[model samples]
Target: MTSGGRIEITGLTKRFGSFVAVDDLTFTVEPGRITGFLGPNGAGKTTTLRMLLGLVSPTSGSATIDGTAYQDLADPLGTVGAALEATNFHPGRSGRDHLRVLATAAGIPIARVDEMLEMTGIPAFARRRAGTYSLGMRQRLALAAALLGDPGVLILDEPANGLDPEGIHWLRGFLRHLSTDQHKTILVSSHLLQEVEQTVDDVVIIANGVLVKQGAMADMRGGGGAVVRTPDPARLSEALAGRGLTATPGSDGELVVGTEDLRLVGEAAHEAGLPVWQLSRKAADLEELFLELTSGTNRNLGPGPTEGVA
Candidate 1:
């Protein structure tokens, strides 16, 4: 666990035939914290990450770990650990066997297999064949395999893809511990907003193969946009507009004040003599912000695919 090393990508572009998968993308993953890689399905997040891991050749630009490409590193496994997909496992191999095989390939110690299994809490089923294991079990095994070399940085793509709620919860805590306590630099990608919200300290948002924004979650959320709920919605809206504050109608006639100062909203309601049903400030949750940034909207219809459900 290394607390902080810099991963810098500059003008990184990848093209598949005429289709540009990634368009001059650039970002950094700081050590000692999780950096989330987010985008819509066609946003090229997976392609960018693959390039970062040396799995794909970029048509232009570059991704570097400590200013060096992953392939150029002497010991690439020691530099980065990755869990790209759950289906990357061999069906005939046992959980422990799978880790052992990768550890051998990486020149890691055989003992690391048991150690990772124990640490990941999958030792009880370590001897179970991988194909027979449930989705949750496969996720754990994949994670264990990634940790085989005890690399300083981790690159994971949709690690929570098939996990149950409890498994997702476990992974969230585990990743945080690896970054905070173990000091591993982690870059994880996922479409699950709630899980990413719980796990990451920073976020890099992308849409339609283009970079949208990237920064600490606190900074983004604190930059003057928050929801303000009130009992007298109509009166509050009028009061806010009078005071030069931007307020919008949220679902069910709730007033959402898109301003920084919570006090301003409160004072306006009080000055207008409106009843304070509720004046609590609400930051857009990760899910809300994700949709807003990716889909460019905040309307939640149902759990179904949309124009760009990435």
Candidate 2:
């Protein structure tokens, strides 16, 4: 039997007055997987999430968690947990108290509050007022509140914001554990593509409030430029270009060469007598592919509704 958490968005659209924030978006997030939701600023990602969480009404169509609308779920907070913003907590409330209030409101056990604080690594600081918490600490408190119900589905937007490197590493492992061990369905919206590439099992890309691409992370591999880490990236770029390959700046101080053939990168380095440190075809083309797909469509791709409808 299926473990149950599955998100289905069908022909979903949202409009703010005359502006089309999300248009005809459709995708599925399966159980036991981490799906990355990516789009540029003003891409309607926030609008869609709001509609899905029932915080805002959709202009048309539907967004459902576990095949039921979020508001219609027998236990809305218990079935779907969303941590959209870290700054929403009350400044006067302690972390433990904030979670306890949510738990009490949802009829969830009080014990889950402490468990979530411990699970999110904020138990020691649980008694501190939220106003004293750092941005990262607020983020952890928000996450602890989201998990207080032990929800089957998680929706996180920019979850890595304000997280240090060590915290990020912990989150990565923690999310993977949630998906793999607990079979929870997760949708993470992030502008940090490299971190998304490392953490997500699938990706759903959108632009101008429209679905652009969606697929398994594995499918994004294979046909990609080689991402090379070298001591001399300028020289390496020149070498790769001399071999008739175009090179571009990639994430993390790496040079991306346009060619799927692994030998081409190796040969170019060997020909230039340059010592190569690392080379791989994994996720090398994601940035390029994302830009290629959303380039001209990111800003006001098309008109929507009647102007000044609000």
TM-score of every prediction relative to native: 0.85, 0.79
User: Candidate 2, which segments miss by more than 4 Å at Cα?
Assistant: 1-4, 225-283, 298-310
Measured on C-alpha atoms, candidate 2 has an lDDT of 0.83
Clashing pairs in 2: none
Clash statistics: count for each candidate: 2, 0
Return model 2's CA RMSD, one decimal.
Answer: 5.5
Please, what is the whole-model Cα lDDT of each candidate in the order they appear?
A: 0.79, 0.83
The true-versus-predicted C-alpha distance at residue 251 of model 2, in Å, is: 16
lDDT of 2 by residue, 107-135 (tens): 98899888889899998999999999988
User: Which model scores highest in lDDT?
Assistant: 2
RMSD of each: 5.4, 5.5
Error of 1 at 30 (Å): 0.5
Model 1, span 1-310: residue lDDT tens: 4443578889987655555667788889988889988876667777788888888888889899888898898878777888887878789888888888888888889998999999888999988888898877887888888888788888888888888988888898999889889888899887656668777899998876678889997766665465666667877888999989878888866777877787888889889887666666576566766778888622222233222223
